[model samples]
Target chain A: MATIEELNKDYSKENNILKKLTSPGGLKDKITQFQADLDLAVKDFKEKKKKKEYALSRNDRATADMLEKDLETIRKNVLDLRDKIQKASDFLANQQKIVDEKFEELSKDPEIKQKLDSILYKKYDRKKKAELNKKQQLETIKQIVDAHPNIQKWLKGIEGYEKSIRKCDKIIDKYKATPPSTPEEQKDLSDAIDEKNHSTKSLADRRSDLVDYFAKNHPEIDKNILENIHSYGNIDRQIAGCEKSINNYDKAMDNLSVAKDTNVVNQTSPSSLAPVPAQKPSWFHPIQRLKYSINEWRARRTQNIEPNPIEPNASAKSTFLEDVKLSKDEYNSEIVQKYLNEQYQENLHKVARQKGNDSNERGE
Target chain B: MENDFINITNEDLEKLSLEELADLKIELDDLVSKVNDMLKTCDDILNKDN
Candidate 1:
């Protein structure tokens, strides 16, 4: 067994690993801790159970309710913890599960078992080596910037978007004070705001620095692609990009005579909106037609009983019983008697003949 | 056994942070599980002798 100091040291090392890995996103540790707590709760539940069983045996109601309340709280906390941990795990990288494996071994081992200790130490040592260097961070920051060009145009678009957005907000506040906007009105407002704003997100303060080159230098791209590369700083360009299709639609809307005007303005096709008929499940009324003809053909061919139509069993039954039945009558009655008698007589005759020959030789 | 647990529960454990609570919970859970397991093992040893 390891000394108390040794055990404490192992525990401390595990704690340090956990502390460093503790990001708010990762619930791997939190859930592990919850599971540990849940187990204690189960133990407490068991203890409470023991008490309840004893009390019930003695007919004590008040004590049981008190224990039951404690148990209820524990159960609620356990359930809540499970939900929280699942949500947290979704957000975090699964790095904490590794830390948990080491923690479990170190905490559980009374003797500090050799294999577990070695695995725990190896994990600890590897983590110590992985501390990210300065050059790596700079490269990562650079890559983040270089990846998105639209991000620069986005930032410049922000100030331009601010005016329309503020107008939309004022409209929203007015709507809130009144009976509220209709769904169509709301959608129009949101779509109008979102069309420009969603693209401009790339230019927001923290991210804006990356795409500044678009706003800082160049009227557009290098002309190979011949695409108009606009700055995020230029929200006018962004509004125009969103408006281009809308402007075309508006022109189309205006060009329409009275009969065609609604179609152009609405832009949605009515034919595709109709729902298709639902097909009933096969089990409800087994389909009339066979999916494959091979099974039907084979059934027509064979003299033997038809194969069961249901899905094949995982394990087929053996033919050994049928084989045993076929062989039973022939081997049971006459054959055993004949075989035993013939063997006994042959041995008996040989022994008697040998004895008689020995006596005759002695007499001569 | 109830009294023993009552004493443990009353030992200022409620005031601790969730992380500290988890640590204490793991320790306690380990102890209880060990005891339950030990009880089963003792029963098995006695049965084996018979």
Candidate 2:
């Protein structure tokens, strides 16, 4: 088994490989080269098909067949490369994670923990500042809430009433539209209607109860403040924001304390175990390069960045399997259609408003 | 409904003592603050107005 130092060296090598594979220039070059090769093979196959050269002579037929084989090989190569690249990326990522976990383990040593104090302290201090700011904001919001007695109750009641009303309306609509095919269905509809009526009554009662409670409990409270209570909705939001910052502050402080308890181990201890080679990695095979290229091309395609064009021979016999090739026209038309639909909706609304205005003028 | 989610009907609010109300406010403020942070992050990602 490899020592921790050897493992660290392996991790670095894998990291470098991952970086090279993901680099835009290297990835793009490979994709462009693949496209160029595909375009040439496709062009040759189409030309022979256009002339009916396959039927004219056995030699032409052999050349056409050979071209078809080449294209298939290229497609397979692309697919295989894509699969390999994905596995390599996943492997490297896992390896990096292992290295990170090892460092975290080392950080738990009392010596290492003491060394990490400054870094951990910096994080904790930032969180403490944020906590103080949030506490101030929360206090402001709480003061507002305190000044407006029954404000929280009013907001909650109003919101609840609205939600309940919507649910009741849906039930009423469903009952009216469907009626009831069976006796059980009829009973359900009746129960739903009764429940809706009860909810409506409950909402009305809550509103009057709020008014009466405020009047009896706090007679000095202004009527205007009661009427415009909804304006203080932002207080609820601000209070929420403050609480989150406080929790984060607490969590960060806890982590800092844990770090303080850990030993201060030397960071360079693992590096000293193995001498890293200066030369390029010999394990980076040509096959890995091919995979990296295909994976990058796929990534670019997913992001809607147009790849270097591989010309399609429209008349050529398609021996290749159908792939979802990205087209600029189809993509552009989707965006155009969305814009046109919005304009159409706006025009409809405008026409209706104009007609209403004209009718109102005639009535006046 | 004793341990149900904090659906404070007028009756429930009325039954609460002054001390309980203060505790409830603190608890709610903490819960709301966490939710608000989560929502802020979502708004940032979507680039939408709150």
The weakest ten consecutive residues by lDDT in model 2 chain A span A315-324
List per-prediction Cα lDDT, in the order shown: 0.40, 0.46
CAPRI-style class, candidate 2: incorrect
Off by over 4 Å in 1: A1-32, A92-364, B1-50
Name the 10 consecutive residues with the lowest summed lDDT in model 1 chain A: A126-135
Residues A1-364, candidate 2: write the lDDT tens digits. Answer: 9999999877655334223433455432343333333333333344544444454465667666665565455445444444433433344344334433543654679786544543444444444454444445445444645676675666566546645565566566877898788998788778777776776786667656655655786554434334323224434544454565656645644655444443322321234222323333478654453344345544754587334332234311121112323244532445334533554565567667777887999999
Deviation of model 1 at A135, angstroms: 40
* DockQ, model 1, C-alpha based: 0.01
Error of 2 at A138 (Å): 2.7
